[model samples]
Target: MTPISSLANPTIKHAAALLTQHRIRKKSGQTVLEGVHLIEAAIKQNFTIKQIIIGQSALSHPEVAGLIEQIAQSIILATDAVYKQIRSLGTGVDIMAIVEIPTPALGVITSDCLILDGLQDLGNIGTLLRTASAVGISTIISTTGTAHLWSPKCLRAGMGAHFSLAIFEQVDYEAILQKVKIPLYATSSHTDKVIYQHNLTQPIAWVLGHEGQGVSEIFLRTATAIALPQPNGQESLNVGVAGSVCFYEMLRQRQFAQH
Candidate 1:
């Protein structure tokens, strides 16, 4: 296909604006995926690819033959200048797509699970996901104030981990409580129960707190609060790191009992 001649092409202009504004994305009910890695991730997660825009120069420089072939959209070609102008990153990827956001499933947990309350760092959210996938946790329920799992940065930082598990985000505080019936162990700085002493073989949901503040008091009023001991001078750990630590301890204990 020859390079696009019209900078005013209705599709191109719309996509350009859509990339810059969150309102347009929400109104349109679409999320943009940049680069081959993210495009591939979205596909694996079964997100609908509404459209794809590829730069003329990128055609041969870094061929995403696989992604292009898999795309179900009418691939719109753009001039290198036009591509550069629309991309959010300085060194833009060869392609970008406006994808339909996958609505979070109402997951029913039959095994160990992780729950988050208002944890908002994209990097932290991603790290928690990667760790969750590694530690035999296949389900996560993210409640009020947590970073959106579908957001671009979280997806990228996750490195495709979203495609690996059933993650429910944007859940309400009360909704999460009603959904999880297993013994919920909420993380807190103040707890008499050391994590090691807790029984891990039982079905559980590890409720994690957000940055700056710990678990919400309402949840603590009902759920058991637990803490992991930190020997170093550091008083606190990143929620993602702390959550990962807690998860693996359960994994370790389970593994030990098996041996």
Candidate 2:
């Protein structure tokens, strides 16, 4: 295909708009993946890549070339000027792919999962996702107040974890509480019960709260409270760190049981 150099090109404009506008993404159920690694990860996970765009400068990169050969859709070559608008500066991003966001078939709400409750920081959301996947938590649910699960910032910070796991975003907190099969555990700075004392082996749904407000009172009222002991006198841990600690503890407990 001829190299697309015009900013007015329809495909080019659509891709740029998708990167910046949440409404467009939500309406179309699509998202952008920047860089070769994410594209490769999506392909490995069998995500439907609608199209792949490669900068003229990166056309010869083996990674880009390999992606072109593997993807069975449009692979557009673009001038650096046009490509520059598509990738964030300093990311060394020479390729980007437009992909359809898969609707998670939440067949059953299983325990041993993490539910993000009103978490606002996109980076923290992404980090929690990566941590959840690391601990073998396959299903994640993000309530209405949480950041967009497929937002570019979250997608980038997730480092390909998004494609490997099942995520249900914009979920109703109350709806889940009504239907969840296992205990819902929420962390608190003031709780008397420490996480270590909790039975981690039993399938449980971990409810991570907002960074500033902690979990919503709705969750606090319905969920069991677990505390993280901070000997350093820190007022609180970052939500991402606190959530990871809980996940690792759960992993440790489950591993010990297998032994």
Candidate 3:
């Protein structure tokens, strides 16, 4: 078992490229999943694992050792110096993996879904995806202007939601509109009809817009205008928070109806 101690190693450099350059990741059809939790999630989902790199410090952990032995992929030990260079963003990440990004066809979406319209902030996009996954919305569609759905920053923020979700990116909402038969609700700061007033149990699509521009007019034309009550007079809420509130409300409504 050769340890990857050299900074110039192609594997290390390639992982670095995936983190810094979105085009490289997309072109190669590979993305880096950092941390033990994310790596485990990807494995649990049975996503294709190309390689697993474990830091020297990470090897002592029982779970890390178990994964290295159980996973039938190329496993390399990384020295602290090398690990620091390729480790995923954030604290306590002593393990990382290079996994093939699954390119599943756009098949029928059966569950309630979320539409991200022109969202640019990676953190917001990730948070919304995480929220959507937590609340049982399995399909998420992102329009052209949105952040790269699989970018490392977004992936980190999403935690493991990406594994559970059927995320379609660079989509045209109008084309989606033609295929989806459910009601599409667009969030509006100006709308009088608050979200609480509506029955959200039925399968529907909630369109969350960009931080600044809001939802595009074209999408709005086909969507029901809905607002969240902002009694504190704050003119607006962060797109992530707004989307989460709507998702939870939908859950609450459906759960109550079930009882």
Q: Say which candidate scores most in TM-score.
A: 2
| Order of quality (TM-score) | 2, 3, 1
Stretches of candidate 3 off by over 4 Å are 88-91, 108-110, 257-259
**How many residue pairs of model 1 clash at the backbone?**
0
Q: Could you give candidate 2's per-residue lDDT for residues 97-194 as a string of tens digits?
A: 99998786455576677889989999999999899988888888888878898987889899999998888888786677766778889998768889
lDDT, candidate 1, 1-259, per-residue tens? 8777676888777777676665676577676677888788778878778888888877764447778877777788898887887777567566888777656667456677888788878789888888988887888888867767766667677777777788787788777777777888887877768788888778888888778887888778887777778778578888888888888888888886554
How far out, in Å, is residue 81 in model 3?
0.7
**After aligning candidate 3 to the native by TM-score, how far in Å is the CA of 214 from where it should be?**
0.6
Cα lDDT of candidate 1 equals 0.78
Task: List model 3 lDDT by residue over 1-259, tens digit each.
Answer: 6678997888888888888898898899898988878888888888888988888877888888878876998888889778987666655858888988766655556568898988999999999999999988988888887888888788889998999988887877666776666888889976799999998888988899989989989888988889999888998999999999999999899886545
Comparing candidate 1 with candidate 2, which one achieves the higher TM-score? 2
Q: How much is the lDDT of residue 204 in candidate 1?
A: 84
Better TM-score candidate (1, 3): 3
C-alpha positional error of residue 257 in candidate 1 after TM-score superposition, expressed in Å: 5.4
Root-mean-square deviation of each candidate, in angstroms?
2.5, 1.6, 1.7
Which model scores highest in lDDT? 2
